[model samples]
Structures are given as C-alpha cells and as structure tokens.
Target: MSTTRHELLTAFDLLLAPERFKDYGPNGLQVEGRTTIRKIVSGVTASRALIEAAIHADADAIFVHHGLFWRGQDGRVTGWMRQRLGLLLGDDVNLFAYHLPLDAHPELGNNAQLGLQLGLVAHAGSAGRFGEQEIGFLGAPEDGATFTSGKKLAAHVERVLKRPVTLIEGQRPIKNVAWCTGGAQGYFEAAIAAGADAFITGEISEPQAHYARETGVSFLACGHHATERYGAPAVAAHVAAQLGLAHEFIDIDNPA
Candidate 1:
C-alpha cells in the first residue's frame, strides 16, 4: 500500500485546516512532485538549507511551519526564490507548510507541546473563556520542582536553542508562564492578562522592550525556529505511526 501525494496532502490540509486562517506564508504545498509520497520529512522552515537536508534524506514530501511566498514578499519569483523553488521542483520533493494553523491547534500546537515537555500542570484552559485571552496557554511547573529564576529558565532555553536566549529583565522570576510560538511579540498583553509571570516567544521587536519594562512582565526571546519544531515533528510521527508511512524530522539550525 502506497500513499499518493494527493491523498497525504488532503489529509494534512484537512487536519491542519490551512485554509481557515491567515498566515504570513503560503500554507499548503508550494511545490508539486511525484504522485506517490513514501518518505515524509518535517522542519521548521522551508529554507534552501532545509530543502537540501530533505533532498539528502531522500524525502518525497517536506512539511514545515515556514513556507516560501510570504505575504509581504514581492510576488515575483526571481533571484533566490527561483533557486530555492527550483531545487525542490528539480528534486521532485513536495513542500507542505502550515503556519498559524499549526500554532493554534490546541492539542498539537507548539505552545501546548512546550508546556507538556516542561512538565507543566493545570493543562486545560479555564472552563469559561473570552476574547483575546484565548490564544496563548497558562500552566505551572511541577509543584515540588524547584521554581526556576528567570536567568535559570533562560539558561534552559539557551541549552535548547544551543545559543544564548535573549533575557529581558534579568532580575525577574518565572513561576507561572505563558508563551506562543513564532513571531508573536504582539501577543504580550494577552499573556500578561493570562496572569503569566513570564512570557516566552520566538522573536522580539524594538517597542516590545519598552512594553516589557512598563508592563512588568518578564520576557524571553527564544529562537523562533527552535520553539516551533516540536509540534509539527510530533504530528509527523503520529501520522507515520497511524498511516505506516516512512517519516523523519530533520532539524535545521536557525538563528531567528
């Protein structure tokens, strides 16, 4: 039994619901290749580097959080775009990307998976919720586990990122935390309102520095790509087990 690219892509779109949300980049398949997909690979971004990794791994399909053709990028497929897309097309590797849909998927979301990995309790959100406070999540570390200071938590993130995490307000402590994956500095207010003692995100902006100081919310800027790889890879593993497809998750180091 073999899985056609169409069948697998249909299942992914149905599962991730890429059409329902607005995203920065193209959400579904950016390149078409062979009809049959035997090996599936996932990564955080569809960079030329990642594409090379997929090709080296002999993957038939690559699913990612960041895809080509960003909303802000010029529509023309010139320069580096041509080279990158050409690599995928030439190699017969299909690319499937899901951005916001992957971030907000409740159980399979990056934020949720982070909480689970860190052993956070109070898993489910409050029974009744409203408005803007809905997107990010709230959770507490294990009760007996020593509460980590902001510096220590940043160190943990640094270890995960394999580089120093940007630690804002080095003096603060992180007891209750909330975070959203990707470039979501705009959601700082929502995290604060969720009673988060600390907030973690993929990237930070200039004004976010002022906002963090004024709001008295501890903020940590972990690498955006590092924080988002978990959910998509986890989902890929589940897909492999359920459908009996060969799958692997190759992590490409990203600085931003």
Candidate 2:
C-alpha cells in the first residue's frame, strides 16, 4: 500500500491541528522528499541514528516529534545538522515533525500517553489544562486509586518508565498530580498554583528543588527521552492504519 506525501501530511494536520499551536518550530513536513510514500518510520527525535535506521529500513518518510530546525538556531546547514539533512536529502525521505501539537493533543500527545502509561487519569473537563498554552495536565490515579505519598508515586513512575526518577519529596501525601513531559519543569509553579500534590516532568531545574521543599509539593524528574517516546509512534500508527501504509517505530535511545 502507498500514499502520497500530500495525503500523509494532510492526515497529520487533521490529527494534530498544528495551526492551533504557537510552537517553537514549524509543525509538518520539515524536509520534502519523494512525492509517494509507502513505508513510514517514526521516532522521538530526528537524530543521525534514527535517520540512518529509517533509511536502512527503506522507509519512504520519517515522522518524529523533534526535527532538525528550531526557532533560534543559526540558519546554517553545517556540522551535525549538515550530516543529518544530507542523509535525508540523499535518500529523498520525507521528514515530518510536530512539536507543541504533539504535546498538547488530548488523546495521543506526549502528556496524555505518559499519563496513560503511569496509570494516571486526567481530571474531568477543563480542569486538566495548566501552565503556558495549557500544555501541562492535572490528573490523579485512575479509578479512585492513589499513590499515598510522593515516594510511592515516584516509584510507580520509575517502574513504568524503566528508568531512575529524581524525586524531591513534599510534605504532604500525593493525591492530585500535574504533569507535562519533555523538559517541562517551567510548569511547576503553575502546577502548584493549580493545587497539584505532585508535579511530574522530564527535567527539573535547580530552583525546583527549593520550591518543592518549601511549597511541600512533590517534584519528579523522569528522563526527557523516556517520557516523550510515545506520541510519534502513536501518531504514525494511526496514520498508517488510516492510509493503508506500512509503519515502523525506530527508537534511538538517548540517556538524557
């Protein structure tokens, strides 16, 4: 089975609605490749390893959450950037990336997927939205379940992600929690304001430790790559099912 690049991009745009987001970079089809795409590869980031793997897999298109270009990066195509782009260009493989849209999507976004994996359920209705662009989510254990304490919650997260989680314990037991995956420590204050007992994100800054201690709100720093590895594959699976195209998820591991 095969689909045109235009069809694939249109499917993604409909699924993510990239225009609704004010993202740091463009959302769809970052690199143009062949007009016809039969097999697609998805990953968390478009690193050199992922590009090589996709090409080696004979993928016609590469779908990812992180792309080559960012808003403030120097516009020069050199160094690692040159090599990555060269590989994609040389093979004529389409590169599609979605940033904030991939984070904010209610059903398939990073936040939603991570929450699902951790067995957390979003608060009913509009209450889940928190932080800038309302990307952060406020939730709790599903089906009236509870974590009892910050340590318990941290353990659960670590178990689910299969990685060590940094925990700054709070004074109180954990009930309601807030989370935004992938370097979203900036949302901690907002999560606190929203009355979360604990806040979970990919990375924690220096100030969050003090804030967690002083404010008595738990903070957990799961790995950035681990938390964000779901959305791209989810989107790709949906697109593949819809378009009758073959899809594979290539995970290029990153410790950070």
Predicted candidate 1 versus true structure: per-residue lDDT over 1-256, tens digit per residue? 4588888877787777877776677777888988888888988888898899899998998988778867777878788888889899999899988877787676776777766665654345572111243556666676635345777777766766576778676344666777776787888777777677777888888877776788766788886887787888877776666667888989887777
For 1-256, candidate 2 gives per-residue lDDT tens digits of: 8999999999999999999889899899999999999999999999999999999999999999999889998999899999999999999999999999999999899999999998889997789889898899998888777778899989889889999999999988788999999999999999999999999999989999999999999999998999999989998998999999999999998998
Misplaced by over 4 Å in model 1 are: 121-123, 126-133, 144-148, 170-173
lDDT of each: 0.75, 0.93
**In model 2, what lDDT does residue 85 have?**
95
* Cα error of candidate 1 at position 58, Å: 1.5
lDDT, candidate 2, equals 0.93
* Worst-scoring 10-residue span by lDDT in model 1: 127-136
The TM-score measured for candidate 2 stands at: 0.99
